[model samples]
Target: MPMAADEIVSLIVAGIPDAQVEMTDLAGDNNHWAARVVSESFRGLPRLKQQRAVYAALGDKMGGVLHALQLTTAVPVQE
Candidate 1:
């Protein structure tokens, strides 16, 4: 079964405690999702590292349950 967007968001938030996650189904299918994650942990991290962190949160589900994820990670924008 395909992973739900909420499930993916929950996993990311669980791993990154203070993350703000917004998940959208880009193709209207659960398999293809776009996620915007804002976290303090991404403050100084490079883009690749930030993506890796999010992927790590999903563990081994990458190739199985979760098909593809379009992720954007950023530190919360300062006012």
Candidate 2:
């Protein structure tokens, strides 16, 4: 079964409370998704670490229920 977009957002928000997540259905199928996550907590963290955090939030769902994900992470700009 494919995962719901809200489920992905909820998991990320649950793990990283300050994260702002935007999800897109890349292939018009729930199985393929693109997620852009922006968070103040990501400041000073390496991009690899930031990506890892998001993946960690998704847990084992990445390969099983969720299928493919194109992820982008960023720190919120201070203006």
Count of steric clashes across candidates, in order: 0, 0
Badly placed stretches (over 4 Å) of model 1 are none
Q: Relative to the unseen true structure, what is the C-alpha lDDT of residue 58 in candidate 1, on a scale of 0 to 100? A: 80
lDDT of 1 by residue, 24-56 (tens): 998886788889999989988899999899989
Note the residue pairs that clash in candidate 2: none
Model 1, residue 17: distance off in Å is 0.6
- Cα deviation in Å at residue 2, candidate 2? 0.7
Instruction: Please give the lDDT score at residue 44 for candidate 1.
Output: 86
In angstroms, what RMSD does candidate 1 have relative to the true structure? 0.9
lDDT of the candidates, in the order given: 0.87, 0.93
Query: On a 0 to 100 scale, what is the lDDT of residue 37 in model 2?
Result: 100
